[model samples]
Target: LVGSATVLCTDKTGTLTENRMALAQVWLPSGEALTLKHGQPVSKDCRKLIETAALASDPHPSDPMEVALHNARGTFAGSESSSTLPIHTYGLRPDLPAMSNIWDDDQALTICAKGAPEAIISLCRLSDDAAQKVLKAVEDMATRGIRVLAVATSTAPDRQWADSQLDYHYTLAGLVGLADPIRASVPDAITECRRAGIRVVMITGDYATTARSIASQAGIEEGEVLTGSDLEALDD
Candidate 1:
């Protein structure tokens, strides 16, 4: 452990936090924010947003013939979205929520939220603006060692009912992000890495501000990260 270094690599999509995106705010096309929860009857505003998201989305359901459903989300190697399936893609589910119109996995639920955080901070109904604040709050939560995700969903119709294909109104519930206190084993690992004189670097695509926020939470100070542009300048 003296002169050599071992590269301990990791993927960040979710292992750092929880794996499903949660619904934060429901912004109506007419510019109103609303909230909808499972088992609770849908609100007029929430239904509007969901209907629009669903109308604009293309959800690929789980069918027995599709062999790629078994693969993990975001990994397209042997899966459908490698340009081979012609119509398949997967994204990170930040706050995984359950709803009747939504498919469980491999399917993208389309429910868009809108608003200015400053305008909707106090409106419990919800707003895009408020959604951002909620996200900021999650970031704040992360600073305090909590993990978080943004969850939102759209519904066409209950899959269990007559026609799951029919598009209907949808709603925006609320935000769901997750986090946990720094685990005990991490300190030992950090100590080991330091003892070996190894430095672990974090690479992220989040905005510099967010990345810095996360870095500080993970005990990395300085609040600065090198972006591709920064790296280019360094090469010069």
Candidate 2:
């Protein structure tokens, strides 16, 4: 029965990449981005972005992106935070591609959010001109074969609101480009699967450019993408 199976559907992050991601760059709303290098000084704005991602992420996330964001935060500062505590968590959902939470330190309450560039942009109250520029930057990064995430921060007015009450009225902080290297064995694995008459289809929430880049590297045949709306439009 296993041998008779001809189709294999799989996730992209762990199955394709090594799951070890590195922060490559950060783009602010002004079209300015910090090109990160090891052991270098991170600008105040960039540090704030990384810190926001860390605070909003899961305490111990199994997702590769969250893990990368957390590690980047640690490298920028040193050691996980010992003070801040989460007050509310807006977990990720299909409609809301981002995740956010409110954290409280002794001083004040802060709201941090992280997610797809477009999704994050929608949450931020950016002017139309600013939004277009940020989207262009995101596309540029993706064209260079890096995954991009948008991070934002705001002041939490209500300390205890239900997740559903969370609003998209936040500051447009910045965008982070992360490099998720393709796994060394993926190309060979795909080759073997093809030899066995199997068709491999990758379905992921990653950007189209990122997906296409990895697919090309892994020797997987690319086809038209069916997004949520596209699926809904299907006539099956």
- Which predicted model would earn the best TM-score? 2
Give the TM-score of each candidate: 0.38, 0.84
Judging by lDDT against the true structure, name the best candidate. Answer: 2
Candidate 1 lDDT by residue in tens digits, 29-92:
2334433233445455454334333322233534211111122112211123232121212222
Weakest 10 consecutive residues, lDDT, candidate 2?
A: 159-168
List per-prediction Cα lDDT, in the order shown. Answer: 0.38, 0.79
lDDT of 2 by residue, 32-57 (tens): 77778888887777788887777778
Off by over 4 Å in 2: 1-8, 158-168, 192-199
